[model samples]
Target: MSRQMEKTPAFLTVVLYVLGFSLLMEWIKPLSQLTETGNFNVFIVFIGMAFFLYAVKAPRWIGIILKGVFILFSIHSLYFGESFFQLTWVIKLCEHVWQNTGLLFSDKLDSLSNEFRSLLFFVLLWLITYLLRYWMLVKRNMLLFFIMTVIYVCILDTFTRYDGSKAIVHSMAIGLILLGILFFQKIKEEGPFLSFPAHWVKWLIPFSIFVSAVLVFGYEMPKSKAILPDPGPFINSILASDRLNGPRGLEGLDMGLRENDTRLGGPFIGDNQVVFEAKVDSDQYWKVETKDTYTGKGWTSEDSKGNSFYTTGEMIWKLEEQGKDTSYGGQKSAFLIYQHPMPYLAYPYGIQSISSGLPNNFVLNDQTEKITPYESDTTHPTIVQYGINYVVPEYQKKELESTTAEGSKNEEDPKYLELPKSLPARVKKLAAQITKGDKNWYDKAVDIESYLQSGQFTYDKKNVAIPGKNQDYVDQFLFITKRGYCDNFSTSMVVLLRAAGVPARWVKGYAPGNYTNSTSDGTRTYQITNNDAHSWPEVWFPKDGWIPFEPTKGFFGQTIVHENVQGSLAEKEQKPLAPIQPKKPLKPQKDLLDNGSNAKIKAPSQSNMQKISSFVKNHKTSMIISVIFFAIVCLFLFLYRKKWMPFILIWLYRKKSGTETFAKAYLLLLKQLDQYGIKRKENQTLREYAVYVDSYFETGTMMMLTKQYEKYLYKGAEDLGDWKEYSELWENLIRKTAG
Candidate 1:
């Protein structure tokens, strides 16, 4: 006797399966909030469709076609913003997929477009749905997937901001029911057939009620705080590679003011805590300190070890020449109130003197130019408030541009020009390309600064990536990710400038913060928050000393860039200070390095045409080969589908013995026969189609198969013992289709 007397679960059990799987899918919704992953609703809909199709026992091919269509529609709606089934976005999607696939292999994950990324997500969902069907329906075992879902939801709840309380509740209620149903089915399959259903039902219902009641009681009970220490931070620390030399400090924390710069390039969350409030004459970047050394990953000060102590009343000049410079415009003072205490005081670039209410001596690191307050007992003092006197210089544009390499050669420091020996050569090559036509160091510096600010890089504090092992931070930011906060832009500019043989240093400080209120003395108070923490590059111009440049996108340095003037002293009075803004912040079509000194904005049509031309030029051979190979594979598959499908069906049903199995196998045979060109007409009955099939094959076996399938289909017959003898007939029919 064959094991063909199969019993499928009732409709209620199938509904339980769908509910359990749908609740499991609820875990995915929170990922959208936690990561860059978006359009989570599409995934939920797909999951529902998958479960619905499986619950109704739809044909496999029908389910596949429906899911594939929905995925295509989703991609069209989400990414393309075009009419459904339009060829335009389809072409665009194909191009994006091709380009991003190449980028993916090259480890440029951040560069992938939303379209291709969503496509990959759809593919993942497809796999997940199939797995769910196999585990829940085929094997009648969803315990592993249920446990995995719980773990996933719990982790997201703990590590991220996702609240999984409702999800857990849903999981528990649905999981218990699902597991109960599968357990019932399992016992039914294994136990003595005559007594199984009535005996199991008596125990199963009460056992389920007991489990659910206990769960409810436990859930409603008052819970105390966890006695165990949270190992989240410890686990995160361990997982985070110890790339930096010093303590991580504020680095990698969801706060501003990172102390250690030994490693950089990872994502960070923004902190809006107010660092300080400054009443200033004008918009100014509050300078904290400067780092000279670039150790591939991040900035470090090679010269901060030695600090010079200064009395509170004395003048501490930030400029090299102090009061003697003709470019020194006028005196300005800023009164700073510190909300967040730090060892160092944030002062302006051309600081003259620091005066405070409390009599505290200050210590200055000459190498980094960082000033810290100290007292009579040789201990550091907390700086609550202080007054800073500084000068805003009116740099002569002609003087700045006239200073050649030959002029500033003697003043150049090797330390400022130092780059890591392991630094990628592409950085230097890129710097050279950006500054190709620029004659003077000032223009070259401006060019490199402008290149960064030219809308190529994005200004993002969150979702910033940390450099992986053997990866250079600047290189990763410039060439790969192209998205970061001030540190990335500043570090990159300094690196590029250094690569181009220009003396530059990375300066960390605060940007000109939001204006809060105005005082009676005409001083504007700016509230500087932790979020206002910023960094930029300061290049050493021999004639003008160190001048700060803003390379970070969306930031405009409020300081002046002196434009070159024509004629002599008589015609050239003092030119008004112009705020340095990025010129032509357009996304260039060519390689970033190819954007030379003449970085003018191109017409959109021209840009698009150029892009097309460039893409064809670069990928012509690969595109041709890929298309041909894809076509060949598709043709091969289509031509031999009828030949291979029967083998697949035979393998699928080889170990199975059931009325449902016979039904499924018959449906598959009908599909195969359709593929085999013996198409069933729409008006024909099953018996008529069977007769036609039998007549075509010159056999009477299909008539017998049809009568048995009809009994299960209409009469709901469970025990179909004739399936044993007819199984050979089914196998013989399948084998005949292969020819």
Candidate 2:
């Protein structure tokens, strides 16, 4: 007789389907590391609800209402700073939708506000959930989703820093189980059998056992080292040359700092190649140029193409004359040794004169503050070395704070305060909030600088986000992705200062390079590498001229302020200031970076263990969630064992035809009956218990099965005629228990 198998319960099937969908959702969680895709938990909550409603057969209108509520709550929580019931977020959302509708009609999709983008994302999630519901319930298949999940994880594992090894394992387990259940369900519905066949379980058991064994072996077995070389370096080498050229081609091939300011915001790798060696009295910021214009994306100067002048003998490159009231205490000289030919000279603040070894005349670009050596008026020269004489000013704090916009040249020029029309309003609002109570421009600038380095922002090099085409760089850095390098910090400070009516310009230069050695005269020679290339903001003060401010965390600039001095004797006794904490070393510890201080240029000497540890730390949240999800899946399987174990037991003893096989299968039957709530009392005899179970199930098959089981136990039977002949009675009782 062909024994029938009971169908898997609808509730169990729904749970499995929901679990499969949940596993696929895990793939999206890693995106938080790369972009401002806030709180992946929101997705999980919504997805779970959607699946639950579908499983319960909830009305379509209820699903629509739930979705609307979720969207509103998401907007209120993520976009607004007030209560959920507040209408401000609703008004803003409506405005964004209307504005974005027009932009969409004009084919300017990238220009949509974040609120509209978030709404679109919510809609996308809704669409995906609907499709998943349709596929798992109506179509009774999830093979396509399974395949897509595997591909998605594999791509992320290969291209991004996301470690998808665990995710791949999860996908395999969930996908196989889901496919197995759906495949069986399809067979139960369409196969020629009038009832569920026990023989199908016979086939299924071996298939499942084989797959589980493969999965266990694959996960637990030792993995062989990859035979292929990593392609990262080869690919990076190809792209490095083009990126080093800067946004504009006019910027010369300087290895350290590029002259490009048109496009900013993205991760960059560090280069340790030494660009120049500077022997200085003390470490100071090596200023290359200052940009005055903010075009929403990057820095530019309105006067970049204005005028040029040629200087021959001792070159004077001062921006403005120092007044008698300004105190210039220390006059220092530094010699620079160039490793390669550079288009411009990098000098310290308060520079008085410059002399180069090259025979080329120096062309001074006033707009860019670039001093380039030329063989003739229009020809280039190879600049090997240069000498600069500068005075490090010790400014009086009282004068600086007291200085107003009365004599400020910056107020007359709008270029220093220029902002793009497309710049987001929130940026200015944030700047105003930061400097609300500050009375003077210097105090406001200081507050803004302090706010950036106040631990709210993170300095990262590898996973920084690049602004989209229509996105404002400063706005993104300030509001969305609050993680970046010196460029992000510096540009934001400049924009904030400008928005607050304090004139500020973006300055790009190298950090006082790493201290290498000291000379006989006590002059320290620092090695400036491509990694030392950095940027900062310079606020224009009437009395102090352009004062540099360090906004980047883990870094401090050499800006010294002195108390007001009345006598000449006290001025003479003002000793030379030592370097303000030497720039951190290029070499890293066992850990690659600590709070990302040396991220400007990191040493490439990370050990294998360090790399593994860093990977674990970066993806710790994902790892924890993966482990919890695995535990939950295991618990679910254990809790529902009765619905699944009968097939395993039947498949196990189907090939055997003896008394021993009969005895073992009969014992399994008793256990299934107890689990199904028809328990066998300790006082009842085997025949009586069987009758009790038969009465509970409203069938006499259990009583007949018990007689065979008792015969197997009492009689010394060498063989049971054919176990298949009596299998129908056992299967009939087991199928009833499954129900």
TM-score of every model versus the real structure:
0.49, 0.48
Provide the clashing-pair count of each candidate structure. Answer: 5, 1
What value does the lDDT take at residue 93 in candidate 2?
76
Tens digit of per-residue lDDT, candidate 2, span 274-366: 678998889989988888878877877766465465564453644334432356667678878765446678889877666553334776666
Residue 6 CA error for candidate 2 (Å)?
A: 14
Deviation in Å, model 2, residue 355 alpha carbon: 14
Residue pairs that clash (backbone atoms under 3 angstroms), model 1 = 265-465, 265-466, 266-465, 266-466, 267-464
lDDT per model, in order? Answer: 0.73, 0.72
The CA-based lDDT of model 2 is what?
A: 0.72
Candidate 1, superposed: residue stretches over 4 Å from native:
1-253, 318-326, 376-378, 410-412, 564-739
Runs in model 2 deviating more than 4 A are 1-8, 37-46, 59-109, 112-116, 134-144, 161-173, 176-503, 506-535, 542-544, 559-739
Q: Give per-residue CA lDDT, model 1, range 387-490, as digits (tens).
A: 77777766766666866676667374579988899999999899999989888888888899889988778888566776654678888898998998888998
